[model samples]
Target: MVDGGGAIQRTTAQFEGPRERLLCLGPAALRTDELLACIMQSGNGKQSVYEISTKLLQYVGGVYALADIDVAELLSVPGIGRAKALQIAAAVELGRRIVHKPSDQRLQIRTADDAATYVMDRMRYLKKEHFVTLLLDTKHRLIGEDTSSIGSLDASIVHPREVFRFAIRRSASAILCVHNHPSGDPSPSSEDIAVTRRLEEAGRVLGIEVLDHIVIGDGRYVSLRAAGYMDN
Candidate 1:
């Protein structure tokens, strides 16, 4: 007797509601294209969800490649519109964060390099400026992180109140600030220096030490403290 092995046909001939299939077999059992089709939920007038997902996977080379795919690239595909593209992007980001999330013990930030490396993968590719604060315990172990601001950084938008709110809640002994430059240049502007100084002052008043301010670029980073901008 001979046996044939082929791809599992988990759903009906018409591609519909892998949601029910997922509920029965769980996510791990579904194929990658099927999983993507589930995330998209529906397709455009021209194609079915499954066909669009297969095209997307082929265009990007594979599922892991989606990690580095930008919205423009996703939109370039035949059936992917802004809404579906954003949905896929959001799902990808959530999965990335979850994978990088620490286990039993919290990760520590011991130096400027450590801080920058921790956030580089998460913030490096953002299209706009994102100001995030790393809350730390006495030993400098990371306790929490807050994305306090999402637009261009300035005194008003990256205000002291928003920056330190999460730190206070977590009772963090110190904070290391991180933000990304969409232009992929880590050079500190005058505003960047001014913002660091202001944050340091606020940290003093609030009894939370401002350890460093790291500016993340494409694959590079600049630590404000290392550059003497935080000497005062």
Candidate 2:
């Protein structure tokens, strides 16, 4: 192609889309929209995959926000159909599982900070609250973890039986409770304190210690024990 300055430009360079760029420079070099486009695979007749992917991101706010959206919501986007929506949802779920997956090396939750850091990435981007239990062995190393309840935007209905049932099953000597605030603020609600105290009392009866309750925010975390909420 000839530019206004009469300089010959490589037309091929201009035609290189995300796939070509990804092949040349790797996925890490592609922008968020480009990555989404690759997952989408194709676009509607009138629009390019790049345009569709960009619109999808804008509609949901951002790439991180995609994690919270379901297939029904994805269908509302201009160029996304059932197939594309399913593909995108699957991709998001896979990403979530990968982040939440346990490592080959067992993780030890020696302190509240350790527990918070362990669940931070998995919980931080969620749109709804999740009450998760970190079941720790005698040495405070993670033996297993489970989500006790997934609830509304602000609350999870957690019962001591549900929480301890999983702990007893896993043979956990101590439990670290973790949950997230979709609002991105780690401040403890009155309900949070009440629930923690309830769990602590239950733990005492079961002879299992409640180490702490860690509230996860956007990138911040608050340890209820450190904040004096777990004092006897």
The model with the greatest lDDT is: 2
lDDT against true structure, model 1 = 0.86
Off by over 4 Å in 2: 1-15
The lDDT values for all models are 0.86, 0.89
Backbone clashes, each candidate: 0, 0
lDDT of 1 by residue, 73-143 (tens): 89998889999999999999899979787869888899999998888886777667889999999999998
Q: What's the C-alpha lDDT at position 208 in model 1?
A: 97
Q: What's the true lDDT of residue 146 in model 1?
A: 92
Cα lDDT tens digits for candidate 2, 156-231: 8889999999999888999999999999999999999999999999999999999999999999999999999997
Models 1 onward score TM values of 0.70, 0.86
Candidate 1 TM-score, true structure as reference: 0.70
Name every residue pair that clashes in candidate 1: none
What CA RMSD would you report for each candidate?
6.4, 4.5
